[model samples]
Target chain A: MKNVFIFTSMLLISLNSYAAPPTFEILIKDHLFYPDELIIPANTKVKLLVKNQDATPEEFESYELNREKVIPGNTQAIIFIGPLSPGVYPFFGEFFPKTAQGKIIAEEEGK
Target chain B: MLLNSVILVLREVLEAAMVVSLFMAFTTVSQQSRYFLLKAIFLGLVAGGFYAYFLPEISNWLEGIGQEITNTMIHLGIFLLLTGFLWLISSNIVLPNRLVKAVMMGAIILAISRESAEIMLYISGFRSDHFLMQSVLSGSLIGLGIGVSCGIFLYHLMIALKPAAATKFICVLVVIVGGSMMSQATQFLIQADWLTSTEPVWDSSHIISEHSLPGQLLYALMAYEATPTWSQIVVYLTSLALMILVIISARFLQGQPKYD
Candidate 1:
């Protein structure tokens, strides 16, 4: 019984060690994007907040990640990114692509 | 750039086609048919020009009202116009059978007017020394040509088919096109700061970029955007609601007594 209890405790500890969430933020202003490049851990869940400070509406989208959302002017929106593999993911503003663009760099955590 | 321009022109042409088809299907009269269509196309171009010329000025002037107001109103206007279009489509008055010529003319006028096409021209990066006049004339001519061609085709098709069946098909087509336009207009309002919201309800930022071809097409046709503000949501919902109500009432009235 003692050995079994020790084994169960070790399993629980190991699971908890690998399960931390990542947090990030983005801002949209003057039809442009701030922090045009974003880096995060691969295969880890991430919470992203996008704030639009411009007078016009902007869209935050990424074909690689398969996500799209509208960020209204003077507002903020929250989004989640996947348990994705490590790589470079690009994003941009839908209305003004030439001027508004960004990327996400997914890398292995603690590597 | 060429392909993009073609696509844009085609999309606008399709819209013009819808308007023309609805008009042609409704009328069997031959008197002044071509004249009516031409006038409609002319008016649409003028309206488009007006919008293009004045939107920026209006937007800039509205700076003091706050972005929220500007966004909401723009969105609201688009929403209202789309809803009005939808209402026209769904009502029992039978689009092709009712004032088809008049509606076509109205839509064309709206399309080419300084308010609509002009804004599109500017946004698409077309500029001239005689900015307003040139834009209006160009947009009107384009819309007119499309409207005339579509009108001619639909008129012939109706002549070949039974009136009852033709009317039904035209009604369905109008609803589809009008609904799509409403969606697109709603998106435009949101992007223009005519609809202000607190936050985007869903953020798919990690996935697709909404500015791509598919995204832009959706934006132009159905007004779908990756991010939408609170005021945009409100305008979309309210406009949809109003459209539905108006359609239902119009249909009911059509079914009731006619003075004539």
Candidate 2:
């Protein structure tokens, strides 16, 4: 009976973590992406908080993800991405394509 | 992926080319107007380059509504300017050549800048780190060739048609484009939480996927969406009707003779 109680609590803790999808942040400053590479857990829906610190609008575009959103300057936007397979997905700002670039790297859990 | 680059760029270039050709055909391709058109295209390219460079700062301004609002404004501004030009032409009052040329120049600049900006972003995003260089280059070239040819085709076709028929066709096309433009504007406003969204009326993705070639073309030309909300439909139809009414009124006014 005591053992069962301990196992139940352990399972509940693990489940609780999965209940909330991990959040990753990306920032755009001076026409470049900060922390340009982000590693995220694969096969889980994730929330990306993209904050633009510049004074112009930049379109966050990713062909692999087939997602596009416009983030106006000095503001933040939320993007829900992936229950995705493990891989590298590249993205860029349309307004400053040359300077604004980044990637989302997805890997299997606990690897 | 390469196909997408080709298609996307083709769409923008074709649109810019179509507008340029339309204005040229309207003016009977005069030497001076051609020079002005070229200048507009050049200026638009420069503007697009600048837009791309400043996007980092500009995109982040105005409390994150900057991108949506700016885009909405650009499209609306184009619609308004076109409305003025259409009215002037239909009025049949001999407007000054310089004024007409200026309007045409403005139109060309907007058309080119919008398209060129799209192309630049697309090309930059799909940099060679991942895809095969040959495939991307060839696909883009093919798309460019097709788009340029299509523009040429439209110019000749417009030139061959009777002026009245041409006017009607252009008016109809403009109205359709304006409808979609307004629809997009409303969408951005909705995204910014300035407007409410109605329930989606229907989903057409089962019939035609947006990623498909025909779908992409339709999306570019008409702003066709597989899933459309009731609000979008309402806005689209209303704008279309409004544009049509304006054109009809202009034509009716054109037919009235002036007695000195």
On DockQ, the leading prediction is 2
- Candidate 1's residue-wise lDDT over A1-111, tens digit each? 999999999988888675534669888876677889988888776767778787555557665554555454566665566556788878887545667899989899788
Candidate 1 Cα errors over 4 Å, as ranges: A1-111, B27-32, B64-104, B114-161, B192-248, B254-260
TM-score, per-candidate, Cα-based: 0.48, 0.68
User: Which CAPRI quality tier does the interface of model 1 achieve?
Assistant: incorrect
Instruction: Give each prediction's DockQ, rounded to 2 decimals.
Output: 0.04, 0.06
Best by TM-score: 2
lDDT of 1 at B220: 38
TM-score of the B chain in model 1? Answer: 0.56
Per-residue lDDT tens digits of candidate 2, residues A12-95?
999978665678999999889988998998877676889889765567876445456766557677665666678887888755
Off by over 4 Å in 2: A1-48, A51-67, A70-111, B29-32, B93-96, B124-139, B252-254, B257-260
Task: Show the lowest summed lDDT stretch of 10 residues, model 1 chain B.
Answer: B63-72
